[model samples]
Target chain A: MSRTRVHNFTISLDGFATGEGLSAEQPFGHAGHRLHQWMMATAFGAPIMGLPGGSSGVDNAFAQQHEPGIGAEIMGSRKFGPPGWQDDPNWRGWWGPNPPFHTPTYVLTSRPRSPLEMEGGTTFHFLDAPGAEALKIAQEAASGKDVRIGGGPTMLRDFLAAGLIDHLHVVQVPVLLGRGVRLWDGLEGLEQQYQVETVSTPSGVTHFTFSR
Target chain B: MSRTRVHNFTISLDGFATGEGLSAEQPFGHAGHRLHQWMMATAFGAPIMGLPGGSSGVDNAFAQQHEPGIGAEIMGSRKFGPPGWQDDPNWRGWWGPNPPFHTPTYVLTSRPRSPLEMEGGTTFHFLDAPGAEALKIAQEAASGKDVRIGGGPTMLRDFLAAGLIDHLHVVQVPVLLGRGVRLWDGLEGLEQQYQVETVSTPSGVTHFTFSR
Candidate 1:
């Protein structure tokens, strides 16, 4: 079964996945990297920071679940780049030559561009489609493997609201981001659809996994 | 020293403390009793429902912490009664004759009325005061004991935003209310002052305690 999963999508206590004033220089805006500090301290996330070692605690255990059966990723346009990435002709991505998503990564945007293949099997395929439509394209590209909903909040909220997510993992950080793009907006009765499990690590971040 | 604290205050995943269309019949509005269901199942909360026994687990431990060190309570007008409660002269609060407060409970409202003394120690004092002024009055009434900030979300947000709270215990309910009175508005960078601790119980609700 081709499942659609969202792993390690971090949000503030107020449910803001990213923060206000997000720009090219400040990816997460006022939030900075506060939302992802827990992940950075984890063993799975440490390698991304070029660190030799990190905590192998519960955080690392959850962080390592990001790339298991994930063959294709569908991310929001904001997640692909900053505000005006479409205007810039040379905007490949934030991840330099070789991006982290080692799959056929689909970027949902109104203004579509040609597929830019990166190193390590990662390719940026810009698609001018809705969430469901984008998911279908990603699913086909995923082949036998599952599709990953790479988020920036708005995209994930739309997918969850539309009942397209199969497995969703959310990390709740303690900080309160006053204003930002919220993840739980319009998701009123979302719990009724999934079996939710939660665990709080020593680092003070609570991990919530909603599985259908 | 009288410390101001908020305890067992539950909010939905999207930061809604209470749902939309709140009325006298539905005290917590569309939220119903979903937010406090975890507390209701605890030994401390079970007694309120006339239950002989309940779970004495981590939820119970946190629920029991509500009363011990409190002498006075200050709640928002919305928490005391329904929206048009001030108009009705016969309104003596929803918590009947012998209310659970058992202390001088201050209700912040623009339309002040005479104090209604109940059967028990609980007395409803209507005051037209802001968060700080109300806290001062509550502190005096509390004497040496700690003063509890009884919330309905909007009131708590005000106290929190004003930086008048010394301790705050927020229960993150799994359900998302979607539309309602939010608790985390204007509370950015709140983690800086408080030492936060998170524990997710088997009841599927996460307890977050922020203490200075």
Candidate 2:
């Protein structure tokens, strides 16, 4: 069924899924990048980033599970980096000409901008509408496939707090960042129950499937 | 300079810090109780465990700073859960009745057992020797100050991996069960760059400090 799923979200041990003061220089925090260590080592990560002869094993097996049948992808403006609206235009989305997400993408932002078209069927549409509105557009664009909630913590918190998400898959990586932005913050007053659907991969990358 | 540091240890998002298939309905996982979530929450996660009017703000503050100047403490057999050893007697070396490790602690174990007793202190020792030996006997016990390593994952991994620990504070909480008794799996190639110093907690809890 079509549902909103936050997939492959990694959190630090200090409750931070992402670090504060995020920038292109430090995409994730010092230890934060370590969270994706497993994913990056996977066959899935190698090919997507255009690496040759990737190592295959338990790590690769788990990496293969990351590409969750994405119909559409949604992200925040901050995640796209380069603050402020692009005036000169030439700001070809975050992932260069060929992004990993090969689907329609809706970016939530305040500034109005034209749709960014990229190679590999990836299009970045800047939505000035509220988060809910952006989600709706993405869902429709998904066309029966699942809408992936790509993030920067704040955006995910907004949707999660608003009760707009149908499922969440959190991958907790074993690394400690003394300071950073936490994932569980501001998520108060939401009573939710989730059963661990599956547990695989010992590369320290654990996946929890949650449905409400 | 004794201070408290919050270490964010990574657990799978599946709610299983270790893996599944625990015996005697051990909530953590079969033998997975060896993974110390409780101790991490105790030493660092005071707020998350809902410590009677705990605040995220308080937790976050401690999390940001580096904890300095810690001394000694105690650990029980029950804390480590089921070891792979067969049961035996004459091994009484956990925290004693009113143990004297007000500073920090270190526990040693091979099998589940009762508490220990020492002059002006306590001693609850287990059969699991070599694996937990060097850590059990250290000078920290004589100086009356340093740090202690807990028996569970919190005590061992946090100290060993982060290279923050100066002593081992192991509390082997007494609980019986079968299966899942491998303390240091997946931790073979840590690439650690540190020197091991030995110390001990008064309550028979041994301490091993790794210095860089």
Candidate 3:
């Protein structure tokens, strides 16, 4: 049974997955790395800082969960690229040549593009499927492992509202974005379906995991 | 210098301070005691259950902060009573003859009413002042001790946005209210102003404290 999961998805106190006006220059917009700075200080996120070792505490333990047994990832177009990456034919994702997602990554976009094969067993497949349809494709591509729902809040909220996520892990950063897309908007009473657990690390980030 | 603070304010994982359509019958609306159940299990909150001994853990320690430094309490009308409470002249408050608040309590409402003197020194004074002006009156009522800014999300958010709160303690309950009044709205960049702390207890509630 292929499961769908969301891991290490950092959100502000106000529930913004990423700050407003995301772009190539600032993928996180006004938020910058505030939502992810805590993770960047973790062992799994040390790569972002060009460091060898990061904290191995509970924060790192949760951050490291991003990779194990994940065969494919489905992400929204907003996450695949900035506002208008489709306009630039030469645009090759924010992550350089060797991206972090070393799996068959399906990018959900209104305008689908041709598959872009990169190093490290990662191939970008653009799809225009809705939540359930997209999950079906990603589940098939996962091939019995698991499919990760990489997000912008809107996409994550869509999947969550559609009841497609089997496991959801949200890291609540202390910062309040005030504005931006909200992940919990349509997810009212969504906690009833899943068994939720919460842990607070010394860094002040609370890790929330929901398993159905 | 009397500082204003917020303590033992419990909110859901989705940031709803209280569930929607709050009324006299359903005080916390659809949320009921779900958000504050963890506190109800604590030593300080045990009295609300007509009990003596309760868990003497971190939650009790945090809940105990509600009384020590406070003299008078200032709260929005929403916290004072249900909607359209002004129409009912017979309505003293939601609490019984001897309310939980044993000090001079100021209720912010557009329609100011004559003070209601209840048992146990709890006096409900309806004021039409805005956040700052209302705080000034509450501070004077405190005489020297700190004034507690009791909340219903809208009132607390106003005080928070106005930068009038010296300390903010929010208890994050594991439950999720799909729709309701949010506590963190318009509070962007609030973390930078405070030295924030987090602690998760066995009761599965995480307490977030922001001290300036």
Could you say which candidate leads in lDDT?
A: 1
Clashing residue pairs, backbone N/CA/C < 3 A, model 1: none
B10-82 in candidate 1: lDDT tens per residue?
Answer: 9988888998898999988899999888988989998787777889999999999989989999999999999
Candidate 1 lDDT over residue span A67-112, tens digit each:
8899999999999899999999899999888888999999999999
TM-score, A chain, model 3 = 0.97
Chain A: TM-score in each model: 0.98, 0.86, 0.97
Docking class of 1: high
Q: Over the stretch A40-156, how does candidate 2's per-residue lDDT look in tens digits?
A: 767777666566666687556645654567799898876676454355477676577888778998888877688888899889888888778888889899988888888767788
- Name the 10 consecutive residues with the lowest summed lDDT in model 1 chain B: B45-54
How much is B86 displaced in model 3, in angstroms? 0.9
- DockQ (Cα-based) per candidate? 0.90, 0.05, 0.83
**Model 3 quality (TM-score):** 0.97
Best by TM-score: 1
The digit string of per-residue lDDT tens for model 3 on B119-170 reads 9989999999899998998899899999999998999999998999999999
**How far is A193's C-alpha from truth in model 3 (Å)?**
0.8
Q: Which run of 10 residues does model 3 chain B get worst, by summed lDDT?
A: B45-54
The 10 consecutive residues of candidate 2 chain A with the worst lDDT sum are: A188-197
